[model samples]
Structures are given as C-alpha cells and as structure tokens.
Target chain A: MFDMEPEVLERFTWYMREQSALTIMFHTKVAEQMGLSATDEKCLDLAMRADGPLTAGRIAELSGLSTGAVTGVIDRLERAGFVRRVRDPHDRRKVLVEVTAGDLAKFAHLFEKAQQSLVQVLSRFDPDEIEVIERYLQLQIETFRKAVINT
Target chain B: MFDMEPEVLERFTWYMREQSALTIMFHTKVAEQMGLSATDEKCLDLAMRADGPLTAGRIAELSGLSTGAVTGVIDRLERAGFVRRVRDPHDRRKVLVEVTAGDLAKFAHLFEKAQQSLVQVLSRFDPDEIEVIERYLQLQIETFRKAVINT
Candidate 1:
C-alpha cells in the first residue's frame, strides 16, 4: 500500500467517473446502432458474454427484468435474428437463450474503430509504461467485478 | 502508428467490452435502488452530465425519445424528485431540465466504495507509474470521446 495525496486520489476519481459516463454513452450508441432497445441490447450482451447458453430465468435474474419482461425481450431479439431459444438437454423444461447471429461481427467495424482508438492511445507509451497501464486496468476490472458487480 | 499484434488488440477489446457491460449493470443497479425506470435513470444521467441544463428538445434528441415521450419522462422524473423544469431566462419559451436531487449524495456510499476500490488499485504502483496510468486515462477518455462518443 502506498500513501497517495488527496489531490491525486481526486484526479483519479474524476477519470474513473468520466470513463464511466463515456462508457454509458458509447453503449447507448452501440444499442442504437444495433437497432435494439437499450434493455434488449443489454440482454443480448449478457447472453453473449455468458460462458454457456443462459436460460431465460437466468437472464431475468442477471438483468433484473421480470420473467414476463424477459419473455418479451427474447421475442424481440428472436424476431431480429439476434438470438434463438433452445431447450436444455439436461433440463428439458428450461429454455436457453443462445446468440444465433454473428450479429456482433456485423458490428465489428464499430468495435474495430474503438480498438483502433485504443491502439492510438496506447501507442503514445513505451512498453514499460504500457505494462503499468495494463496492470492498472486488469486490477481495476477485477476489483470492480468483485466489489460492485458481484455484490 | 505503432504495430500492435492481433493478440494485444484482442485483449484490449475484451477489456473495453467487459467494462461497457459492467457499467450498464452498475447503472441498472443504481436505477433499481433508486426506484427509477432504466429509461428515466438514463435520461437523468444525461442531464447530470450535460454542460448545463438541457432543454426538453435537446433531451429528446439525445435520448432518442419523441417530444411527447420526453414529456412523460420528465413528468415521472419530476414526480420522483430527481429533476425539475426551469424556464430558460434567455429563452422563456424553452424549458430546461435540471437535476434537483441531492439524491446522488445519498448514493455517496456507492461512489465512495468505487473510489476506495480505485485507491486500492493505485496503491500497487509508485508515483511515477501512477503518472503514466493517469496520462493513459486522460488520453483514453479524450480519444474515445472524439472517435467513438461523438461519432
């Protein structure tokens, strides 16, 4: 642990807050570009990130949507060809949501543009400096997930 | 332009996507805890981040809501005491949306926790390394705003 000054902490705090606001704006743009409501895009993002296919119940739980509302989200996503409902072989009664469209790849140009922007920023630093930034990002994400997301 | 291999770009891409998803989830949690609908919370976020108070028309344009729909959103947010409508002094016909709630301070614990998490992460690096991380953050936010958010 290191003793950092209050001003230093404040500056970092502003960075975090600003990054967070930009992230929300970026995702809003992403959802609009995808022609999905923010809620639907968020659900699709949830399903896409899961290690395995997620059941509707699970998505509802994760997204804080009602079971009934999740049904509607699945319906819209299905109609848009973004996802498919499949029965779980292990549990025949459960309907799992799977992202059937490489719909994400369709947006690769946008993501790649974002990646390029990141590349441009990273290019300014030397390898050793990049290492420090990478370490900070990795730790920030890990700690945020544990403290905020999972909590 | 520095050459970044596919693997490095890919890793950073994952970080961006993960951070985006987590930000949405955190906002959802904030909304749920605040008893505001996601749309209202998003609009509130927009107002809170604006350079000054926003007109209903600007909110509509930014939020992708129709004028009528924006009226409803403002009604709900106002009733909930999260925001208020003020007539612009220079343009009396224009109504501006203002966030009136000290309500965010009520959520200070959450922001404080996030700040503390950041403090813990920064403690791992020396001051010089911290400066590098700060520079990267400043550049990342600037580049992202210009390249992604504005576009």
Candidate 2:
C-alpha cells in the first residue's frame, strides 16, 4: 500500500540488516559477560523484561525455544545466580522464573554504557526531530514484529 | 556529554531492548527453518555479510566463537548447503568460507516481507523526517557497535 523510491528503500533495508547484525553481536557479548550461554541469557532477559515472573512455558514461547530447552536454561540461570524459581504466589501450584535483582546490578556498567551511547545519539536531534525518530521507532518495531511473526 | 530527560531515555531504552529481543527471536526462527543451530546460522551470517569470502579464523573472530567451534559450525553449514569451504586464491593453503547464493534465495520471501515492513514504516514520514530517522539509525548503529565491542 505504501510506495518508496527504490534507492531509498534499499538504503533503509541495509540499515535494518546492519542493526539486526549488531544487535545479535551485542547480545552475544552480554551473554558471554554474564557467564550464561546465549540461550540461557535470552530466557533470563524474557523474565527480566516481563511485568512479573514468567513460567518456563512462557519463556519458551517468548524465546521460541522448546519447553524442555527452557527448563535447562532456567536450571543454568538459577545456578548462575541470575534467576530463581519460585512458586507463583497467585497460584501456588505454578512455578515462575524471576530474575534475581542484586546480581544483575553487577552488570550495570555495561548497560550504562549503552544508555550513554543512546544519550549521545539523541542529543544531536532537536525536540521535533526526536519526536519523529520516536514515532519511526514505534512504527518500525510494530511492523517488524508482525513481519517476524508471519515469517 | 549529553543530557536527556529520564523518561525519554527510559522509553528509548525500552525500544532498544525490545528490538534486540525481537531480532534474536527472528534469528532463532530462521535458523530452525534452515535446519541449523542458532550459533551456526550466526556464523554463516558473518560469512555472508563479509565483502568477500572469509577464512575460518576470520569467522571465528567476527562471531566470537572459538576456532574449533567455528570449524564445527562450518562443517554443519556446508552439509546443510548454506555455505562451502574453498581454497583462498591468494593462498591455496588457506581455506575460506563462502555462502552458497542459490540456496538462500529460497528464503527470499521472509526477507522480502521484512523489507516491506520497512517500506511501510518509512512511507509514514515525510522526506525531512526520513532524513532525521536515517541519521539517527546511522549514529545508533555506530555508537551501539562501540558499546557492544567495549562490553
């Protein structure tokens, strides 16, 4: 339904592909630093980002990993002190995976550096430009998620 | 060196994190469809993105996988028809990993869908806003890469 000039479309595609590669590399580094395998680190990220603790099944769904694989990830994460298994208070029979707060604080410097880089990038744009950028990010994320799900 | 309101920074951080998570999931699904492990696919990606064929040592460096691990990844990818090893023309004793182009073309629909999503996102903005977004993406990629490497 939307039309873009071929060259412009090609440039944007390159940017998206570059961003994707860099993101994967960033996660690999983060996972290495946390002493967790990439899969385990990704599962922990799912738990950390959730509004509350997640069941192993929920993490499996979010990470696109098998339930059995998620169980192993949780086991390793628990041993690494990055997460813990707790009975869901709202449902006593349900086990939930919760990220351990204090331990992740040790990795603050890494995330802070990322935040600082973001601040630097944002600073170059005025309020109006920043607004446009924000809108673009929101739309891009929404559209890309739909594309990925359909894939 | 730059200042941003706490809330704006927080929002941007959330976007970055969400994008990162989605990218990982996309890679996982793509790998599953290609019958390769996530790590092998990542290595193959490194080879594919290079300007020319890469030696196994180069792939190992770029992917953060050990040399031995990269060897296994190459072996698997070769068997799966995603990549092949060839003697470097400049030095016959050296082996290089090269992506097999025809096979990846079979997955064009997935990538084309992703490209279409980008087109849709960009079509919402005027030319000036598109320029701002492009600059933002370039800086974000550069700064994020530095952050990732330093991490």
Candidate 3:
C-alpha cells in the first residue's frame, strides 16, 4: 500500500457512502415499480442471483428470516408472479423458489435504463481505463464479501 | 464515446449486478447489527443522507409510503433511538425526522469496517489509477441518477 493524503481518504469515504445510499434508493424504486415490498423483492433477487432456485430454508437462512416468514415471503412472491414454488425433483419433499422471467419482463424497461446508464458510463473510458475500473469493482466486491462474513 | 465489444459489456453487466446484490446484503447485516428493521434502517439512512432533517411528508414521498405509514416508521425509529422527530423551528406545525448520531454510534464499528475495506481496495492502486477510479464512480453515479429520474 502506498501513502495517501487524509483528505483523499475522506473524499473516497464520502463517495462510498453516497454510492451505498443510491443503491438502496434504486432498489426501493425497483420494488415500488414492481408493486412489491422491499423484503419480497430482496428474496426474489436472491433467487435470481442464485445458480438455481433456492429452497425455502436456504432463502430463510440467507435472508435472516424465520422459516414461517420465508413461507409467507414465498407465498407473496408467488402470488405476485415474481417467483414460483416448485417441487425439487431431486428431493420431492423440498420446495424451491424460482424467479419467473416472464413476469419479470414487465420490469425490464427499468433495468434497461440502468443498463443504458452503465453503457454510457463505460463509453467514456478507453479499454485500459475500463480494465482498471473493472479490477477495482471486482476487488471491492470480494473484499466486502469477506468483511461482511467476518463481521 | 468509445465502442466496446458485446461480450465486454455483458461481463460488466454481471459485475454491476454482483455489486448491487452484495450492497443489499451488507445493508441487511448493518440493520441487524443496529437492531433496526430494514424499513426503519432505510428511513434512517435517508435522514442521515439528507442535508438536514426531513419532514415526515418528505420521508413518505421519498420512501413511497403513506403519511400514516410514515408515522409508524418514525415511531419505531424513534423508539429504537435511530432517529427523532423534532418540531421544525421555522414552522411549528411541521415535524422533521432527524438522525441521532449518538444513537447511531452503536453501529459505528460496522461502518468503520466497511470504510477500512474501501481504503484497502483503493490502496491497491496508485494515485493516478485512483483518480481514474474516482472519476468513474462520480460519473456513473451522476448518470444513474439522471437515468433513474427519467425512468
């Protein structure tokens, strides 16, 4: 690590705080647009990000919700068509929460706008600069993940 | 604007999604550590980010909650000592939601850990590279704000 001025660190801290706040606000907007509660949208997002549909208990564990609460969350999400409950074929007794892409299409425009914003931001940088920014993001996420776990 | 390959754009899109998801998870942990619900934490976050205290109506508008719902939110936050409702000095009838920093200090260590992670990430880059990263962050946030509003 190289030496840096205190002022620079302070400014970077502000930037990080600003970004975090904006991220949550953007999510709130997404939840509102989809007519879902923040909790429900969070569960659906978890399902979408997972490699496969998550079991009810797995979502409960990851979301820090009780089994009963996860059941209610799944019910609400399924009723809204954001997610569906499917019997896990490998274990017929287990149920999985699957995101419904068809229903999610309704919110595509909102995401597409965000994508456009990203594309526009990237357009400003050259390949080398983009590579640098990408590395920064990758490292930041990985470090934060470890930090969150340790916390 | 510079042109980029489709695959490159796709990779960046995945990175963006990853970052956004991790942000929400980190927020969940923060709320849990602070003994606040996600909704209450969100409102407190809004109050913290604002230039000054926000009126109950403004919080409702920003949070997309009804006035009655906001009243409940304020009550919970105040009871938890995360925020307080203060009479607006200029307008006696108006009440403003103020984030109580003294109460928030209980969770300062969590934020400090996040800050340390950010510093560690930035330390990986030299000053010039750090400048590029900062510029990218600033531009991305500004563009996203415009896009979110236009949508």
Candidate 4:
C-alpha cells in the first residue's frame, strides 16, 4: 500500500510554491524599504543567521550558492557597510564575514514586523498541527540537502 | 485560550525563513541552468503559470512586482527569446505578454523534474501525515492572503 496519498503530495507542492511566492513578495517589500537589492538582502540575512562569523565558503555552502557568487555577495555587503570581513586568526587564508551591528539595528524593525505578521497569520493553528508542519518542513529541508548532495 | 503555543509560533517563523532561503536557491539554480538571471526565470515562470496572455499590469500584480520592474523583466525575457508582447487589439493602451513555444517546452520539462524531486522527498510521510501537512499548508496560505489584505 502507498504510504502517502496522491492529493497530499499535490498539496505539499502547491503549498511550497505558494509559500515561495509569499516570501518573494515579502523580501521585495523589505528590500525596497531598505534601499537594498534582493541579493544584498539575502547576504545580510545569511550573515545574521550565522552562529558566528562565517567564511565565504561556508556561506556559499549554507546558501547553496557558488563560492564565486558568495565572494561577490560578501564584497557587495562589505561595501554597503552591512557586513565586514575579518581575517581568521587560526587560518590566515580564511576571512570571516560578520554582519555589522548597524545593519542588525536597521533591519530589526523589519524582522520584528515580519515576525508579528507571521505570528498573527499562524494564530489559528493548534500545537499539534504546528508540530506536524514543523516536522514536515524539517524533512523537506533535509530532503533538499540530500538532493543537492546526490546531484 | 490561545490556539498556538509559543514554540509553534517560533517554529513557524523559522520555517518561513527557511522556505524563503530554499526559494532563492531554487530560482538561482533555474536561472543558472537557463543562462538567465533570477528575474528572467521569474518572468518565464510567471508567463507559464498564467492561463493566457497577461497584461503588464496583471503580471506585475500577480508577481508582486512593480510595473516598472515587470517591464524590465519582460524586456529581458523578450531579448532572450522566452517571451513576446502582443498589443491588445481592442485596447492599444494595453499589451499582452505570452511565452514562446520554445520557452514553454523548456519550462515544461523543468517543472516536471522539480515536481518529481519534490514528490520523492514527500514520499517519506504516511498517508495521514501527508494530509495533515497539506491541510496545514492550505490554512497557512489562506492566512497569509488574509494578512496581506489586512496589511
């Protein structure tokens, strides 16, 4: 017997696309407000999401962007004063990229607004449903990573 | 009583951000594969997703892009042979945009491949789990639409 129904798969794909579209719209709005390009916003986002200062290679890997592409992103971000490149003490050849405090402060309100909006939108779901969705998203992310590896 | 737990809300926000990252990656991959920019791939995708020739205003509205941005995207797509603009016979002030047959064929294969990959990834869930996820996503999309309207 099939583990999953066909309609389920269909809906999942539909949801993914719809979610993708919403995200694009949100980012465009935020970027326009910040006077930043989409890519520049992404670079800043990646830097902010990092646990600590990250190398360009690591950012590229996490972002599924090419190393060369990440280099350009870093260059642009650094030039915009959103991020800085600090030489790694342990590895002379490695440059750690960090999001500036100013950038974080600048985007703080936008992030807060987005969070509030999302929280309101999701206020209808119960804990169990939210758990299921979270698990499904985790699986989706893992699956994407595996696909990239296999490819 | 609150329907959502705090953790659930936090997870939902994280999921949204993760979904956003994945979309940017997917768009970048598609663009690179077609030797196009992200905007170009989006223009093609928008054209393909449309039921028929769409006006510039309609495309901009549906794409969550500004009219000027849509015009630029159309120019790039036209130059790349992916789309053409047809002036509305009844309304000279309006132009209708359509995907070229070659572009349609190309995007058909691409869409199929993406669907297959997504379906494979979703194959891990049981039937009930899949339905739950789908229902949850449907609700989320509806909620997002409401939020956008309210905003």
What DockQ does each listed candidate score?
0.71, 0.70, 0.76, 0.46
Give the range of the ten consecutive residues with the poorest summed lDDT in model 4 chain B.
B142-151
Q: Tens digit of lDDT per residue, candidate 4, span A1-151?
A: 2465677666666676777666676777677667777777877787777788888888887667789988888888888788899999999899899778875586667667667666765665566756666787887776765554343
Location of the lowest summed lDDT over 10 successive residues in candidate 1 chain A: A101-110
Which portions of model 2 miss their true places by more than 4 Å? B1-3
TM-score of 4: 0.81
State interface RMSD in Å for all models: 1.3, 1.9, 1.0, 2.7
At residue B92, candidate 3 shows an lDDT of 91
Runs of candidate 3 with Cα error greater than 4 angstroms are none
Question: Between candidates 2 and 4, which one is better according to TM-score?
Answer: 2
Cα lDDT tens digits, model 2, A1-151, are 3456789888888888888899998888888888888888888888989998888788888877788898788889888898889988888877799888999999887688888899889999888888899999999889988989877
Highest-scoring model, TM-score = 2
Preferred candidate (DockQ higher): 2 or 4: 2
Native contacts kept (model 4):
0.40
By DockQ, who's the top model here? 3
**CA RMSD per model (angstroms):** 2.1, 1.8, 1.9, 3.4
TM-score of chain A of 4: 0.75
TM-score of the second chain, cand. 4: 0.78
Q: List the TM values for chain B, per candidate.
A: 0.88, 0.92, 0.94, 0.78
Query: Candidate 1 lDDT, tens digit per residue, B19-113?
Result: 88878787777777788887788888889878889999999988778999899999999998889999999999999999985867776675666
User: DockQ score for model 1, please?
Assistant: 0.71
Every candidate's fraction of true contacts kept comes to 0.71, 0.78, 0.73, 0.40
Show the lowest summed lDDT stretch of 10 residues, model 4 chain A. A142-151
